[model samples]
Target: MTFAELPRMGSGRVSEARRQHFHAQVQEVVVWMRQYVRRLGFAPVARSWLYALESEGKITKGDFTWASKWLADRRKEGLIPFELVGADTTRQLTGHDNFDEEATPREYINRQLRDSLEQAAMYWPSSYWKHQTNYPILWSEKKDVLKLFKPELPDAIRRFAGKGQADVNSRLAVVQECQWAQENDLQPVILYVGDHDPSGIKISDGIAGNLRQIAKVEDWECGLDEMESDGRIVRFGLNADFINNARLLWIDGLETARDEAKGTNDLANPRHPDHGKDYVQSYLLEFGPRKCESNALIANPTAARALIRDELWRWLSYAGHKQWEAENHDASKEAAAAAEGIKRMLAMFDSAGVLYNPGLIQSLAQASLPGLPA
Candidate 1:
């Protein structure tokens, strides 16, 4: 039987088959275009361009114009995002015949490395340039793939270990340098720079601990002592002091630590002394009353009261009205009362132009009181 004489299928069945075929074709074309664009740094041929190519066997002025308009329309309708390809620009370069394979491997590597470096630099600021070092060399042409350290290079070199790869030798070198500095009576200081997350803190702690042990054995002061004395260490950044000084107080857990600290201060000096009251007050007011309950409030009632007063003073200073009542206010309403108190305190800060990031506050608050309603 001839193809034209073949019996026709039901309209519904034919439509379903056509729909499946069209979907498959579209998916195939999308995948191909994605690969082609990534390699050629531009979009592949549009539908009209493909049709023209199949019809005319080459791209012409009229075909190019039609394809451009078709692609523009698709883009306008959000069907496709437009991009220029090699073919689009090459048409302008009349003297340029074709791409040549004469480019050296070194040139290509250099170009790629430069581009990668430029992209990486965007994550950090220009101030980081002072800490940049030439060590921890990235070796692209070696079995090991990286030359971690060179003995002749200066100590305290900052190096990038590509994703998932830690430079053990470089870390060991830092440890060795710390030991040497201690032996030579040179104060050893190692400032760790990493993300402000838990893993980063742990890594820094491990490094500091190792250096401390090494310094003790060698009877030398190692790791930041010298830098601190000389004022070379930046107080900011992810340093040991910054981490240690940080108080991880949450709204719910405030009473536990505040009460403990207050008890210690009260027991240490029971004479009702005014000294150190500021510190005690800060703990109670900023962390205790708002976040914790009376029972959970730190044991030193004096300190707790002082803190509450200090927070009240801050609120008052910022134009937070102590008597301002929230809408539908009822002293008997527990949740509303709590929320009202918080809003009043926050309003004080807001009035004073002190903006607290709600997202961060919410996150920390949630972490502190996992079961409490936000």
Candidate 2:
């Protein structure tokens, strides 16, 4: 039985019939979740999965907290594959022991050397935006939302601006990126995705100003007006059109950082300190009392990926791809020339009777090489 159906701590026992019903429901949920995840192809975050189920009438909105806990327990018991759920990068393990016990120290050294050699053989031109006039950075308000569509954004720098405004570190990183891009004769641009809410709308609108402010503090002299005039910082998703077309879920209430801190509910409420703000008033007039999160796009992964790809294609032109192909051809020729030089160097070592020495190879793997990081 659900929590609401349970008796008070010591009042009475549950009927066996009700108990059986709860068990049957649990089994049905498990089977449905398996099939659902399998059909979806990619694992969505827990909230998105809940939204999908709710939309299909498999569960009510009230079931979220309990269902999430139940699903997590099942995953922990190994009833579900961990890969069936997207990882939450917020909570993480760091600096932990990550050694492999299956290999001996000598075997590990051999594997490392072989891996390095394999990488050397596969070298290509490393620049992704090499032929593009403008370098695009994919910016999302939420990290979880960004993770949903990040794989399709291969040609852009991915950045997650956490809740509300970006942190100081995030702003500094973008400023440094813009500085480097300008130095290399590239124009930096941001493709933004955020919720369509009071704060979310304003957050995307203020990104250029945020970057410019940080750049100025660092003594960088570049005009961000071009980013605005040329439509560089484009808010491409979670807008009214995308939400309506994608059939996204709209959440009730105008929640903000202040509301969260104060343990209050809606920012549009008269009692809210931020209710009188122009952005809040505008959002309320435009959207009523509901807001759609960018995460709602996670319910349809195919459309989500396509949305990002279409925006990227606008900047990545046909001419750019041809230029990239030409650059790759030249890079491959240089790689072949380097390979010949390496072969000659190895032949000299072979002539000296030391090319096939296993002991020397082991020593070289253990020692730090010259002109490389230690």
Candidate 3:
């Protein structure tokens, strides 16, 4: 409610004029903030932004949903997904164009049924852990690193975004996600890529620290002792080794080199003071106290991907890939077997009916795969 709407004093407490004046002063600030948020929202809604607003008290915890509604209104006006929250997606019936594209009705039904059966039967392997004694990989994100990687990743792996010193909520979210993975009987292996500097270095620690604290306080199923012994976290890139070897270009001044809107960074951020006991003296010695943002590594997208692939392959092998393929082939055979009776039943009905529009199904039983009776 606006300040002006507050109950007036009975007598000599505060005048109605004073109340209105106070409200006008307060509304000036609110109006400015509302305008600012509206302008920023020309872009897609983000979980990070929602969290930020809650932290800043712009949106109260009790009214957390207000920001989402505000963003949704903007999205309806036509804003593409930044992360594509499934809840905010356009809902459609089975008659949608995507269902019919390059497909016959029988084929579509057969496909839908087969897929449902596949899910129900749980024929697919859940993860690398289910396949073997192996564990899951947790990959980290930095500015546009998501844009660089290929879409496909193994079932045993998950991805997360860390803009910088991952805010408390984001950090806690990461902790919960990793903890959930551990509960599912998968060893957590965190593989991160970010700025090769103080804040980036500390972020990895910050996440672990918060996770450890929660595990202890909450008496989680997977305790800190187990996590300390079994869990593994490693920073894999933009290291001095890769920097010197790959010769990733640098921008002498990060403050000057950044185009905040574009999110383009020149790597050499001068924010952190390079100390004698910095994590890697070689990095400081070679780069001369210069910083390297995560993008510097992926600047050569081909090499960066190759590097990540090589790291993942250390955990996953060709045998693992083939194991998945073999499982898939068996599932395909099973689905085909289950669908055979339906095809025959449809084929018989077509012959019995005088006015039957026997198009593709007729062609299928009379001509398609040999399993269906002619």
Candidate 4:
């Protein structure tokens, strides 16, 4: 029997089995057609097949006409395949009309798939670096030196002597700067110039993280605290008064109180004699609000200058220490060294106090600041 009249081998009704066999035959034909089209490097066969199916009433004539014209046009444009018809092997077959201009179903499906894949790929994390340079004057006469900061800064701080705002502005600036650098095929190196303080350190870290996230450049560098080429460290400018206020609020009296209260105990009950819980609670309540208020007020110029000078001195000393270590020591080593150094310095301070001398504190401060003579 011919291919269409052959008996289907299966345990179903004759018509059902025949239908299944017919579907399988159609699938095989499609597979063969694909192979034939690939090997012959032609597109007219797809149009011809659609036209034949339409004539046989298996598909709509409109669809067949549209597909045929699309294939023909694409083939002419080198987007589809075509066969040479003339002796010169340059002329192509073209006589059909009533073609549809809309995208074919298969083309539409492919476009959607491609778009979905692109969107999925986009969700993957990416990073980049953004560089900035700033120079703050020392009382208005210092030459401008390069100091970098990231992402991008706000319009306020975009130029010199501009208003410095929240950490968010600095972070966003760094990110924007990094994007600009990446587009221009340059690496970012952010430099900042500011007074030293806890907030400055925190801002540096924030800018670094923000740039790293935006550019998807895990290897990219962006931060104000980065070291300069000449081995000097850069930092975000802190309000000198803010640093002083923060030191007074967070560090100063707590260390003294803890030290002085070390051996004092209630002699009443040995098991819980050292429970200075009441004193600790009182310290927290009394100092916490003042510290919070100090932080809030220092950002205001009117309140900033009134910050205690001794607290500012302590902050400057601490900041100078951090800058020195960031410039001269490896980060991991610096942490360990700093801990040891602090322990040694504190012991020296205590020793000096017992001997009624203040030279040890000065020596420790000098040691912490990088450029000070040994």
TM-scores, all candidates, are 0.21, 0.76, 0.52, 0.20
lDDT of 4 at 201: 35
Model 1 lDDT per residue over 20-101, tens place? 6644543443454455445333233343234223222333333445555645554564444455221233245466667535
Is candidate 1 or 2 superior in lDDT?
2
Candidate RMSDs in Å, in order, are 32.9, 6.5, 15.8, 36.4
Local accuracy of candidate 3 as per-residue lDDT tens digits, 76-153: 634323233223222433464553553577677556665765554445543445554335444464534544444335
Cα lDDT tens digits for candidate 2, 1-374 = 22222111123787878756755555565566667667665577776776766666655656767767766776686655677777776676668787676556656755665566555555677476677677777778766667667676654454665656888888888777766777788887888888899888998888877777787788773546666787888989888977888777777777664434445668878777778889889888988888887777766767788898888878766687777777777877777677667767766866776656767655666675655333
State which candidate has the highest TM-score: 2
By TM-score, rank the candidates, best first: 2, 3, 1, 4
> Which 10 residues in a row give candidate 2 its minimum summed lDDT?
1-10
* Best of the candidates, lDDT: 2
lDDT scores in order: 0.36, 0.71, 0.53, 0.36
- Candidate 1 overall Cα lDDT vs. reference? 0.36
Candidate 3's C-alpha runs over 4 A off are 1-127, 221-231, 254-287, 350-374
Local error of candidate 1 at residue 17 (angstroms): 11
- Candidate 3 lDDT (Cα, whole model)? 0.53
Give the better candidate number (3 or 4) by TM-score. Answer: 3
